[model samples]
Target: MYKLKTKETDNSVIEFIESVDSPKKREDAYQLLDIFTETTGYKAKMWGPSIIGFGAYHYKYDSGHEGDAPLVGFSPRKAKISLYFATGDTERENLLKDFGKHTTGKACVYINKVADIHTDVLQALINQSIRFLKETYPNH
Candidate 1:
């Protein structure tokens, strides 16, 4: 059986943020903590070793793989902050137009810092991700 790596843990989100070596990154993590929590209306959670996640959902694929993951999350990484959201939402792509300096991959948005992006647009992205996940997988 295939296993998912990004499972939620009981680790402290604050502790993880504090572990960041760069003080500026730590500060940005705190700012993102506040923004993501307020946007998702859910408390922060530690996903795997590095991701600070909010709400969660359970997803299963046709190939029989399944796992639980955060509805939205971010990780303050050494290179850049990574924002996790639903992968296929056109609304998310449209909102990224005004999101400020950022790059994105499938399901992950990368920014240098919280200040590099507009918080309003970030909030909108998260909202769209949450709604998309809930509508797509209501069982979890």
Candidate 2:
């Protein structure tokens, strides 16, 4: 049985943000905290050691792997700020066309800083991810 490594914890989201090595990244993290919280209407929570997540849903795959994950999240890493969103949403791709100065990998959009991207598009991505997840995992 495979266990999930990124389980939600009681750790302090603020403390984790403060521990980020770069001051600029730390500030961006704070701005993101506010943006995500306000957009999702859910308080941020620490997911795993590094991810700051808002809201959550349980997902079960066809392979019988099931677990809970945040509806949307972000991590201010050393290289870039990773924005997490739903993996299979076509709307996400459409919105990202106007997102500005960002790169995407499967489920994350990486940006150098908050100013590099449009916050309105960010909020749309967040909302879309939540809506998609809820519809996909209606029972969870």
Candidate 3:
């Protein structure tokens, strides 16, 4: 099995984010770093190259694939900022409806730009996501 190299080391992660060309994107990433740290009560760490991750959780599925991952975090990708929340089964659709302006994947919420969304809604989403992660992955 091969693990994704997106997150390989902390220094690499910092370097990746710091190297982003846009000041606005860098500032947005910093803002998210602050929020994820505060909300998750976990010191921000580079998950690999670009992910600013929070708490760690161990997960095992019925098929037996298991690994550890951050309880919640985000990656400022080239196209959008990917906010990671572990909820995938009907946990935040209501909030998603009014998430200002964004898109979603199975476990990620994507924002084209921080300014494109409402900060208040984003805060609520992050708060809700953190609570859900803590409840779902208590030991992590």
- Best model per lDDT: 2
Q: After superposition on all CA atoms, what RMSD does each candidate show versus the true structure?
A: 0.7, 0.6, 2.2
What TM-scores do the predictions have?
0.97, 0.98, 0.83
Error of 1 at 4 (Å): 0.9
Clashing pairs in 2: none
Clashes of 2: 0
Least well predicted 10-residue stretch by lDDT in candidate 2: 100-109
Which candidate has the top score in TM-score?
Answer: 2
Task: Tell me the tens digit of each residue's lDDT in model 2 across 12-58.
Answer: 99999999999999999999999999999999999999999999999
Q: Any idea what lDDT model 2 has?
A: 0.95
The residue-by-residue lDDT of candidate 3 on 93-115, one tens digit each, is 87777777888887788997777
The best-first sequence of candidates by lDDT reads 2, 1, 3
Clashing pairs in 1: none
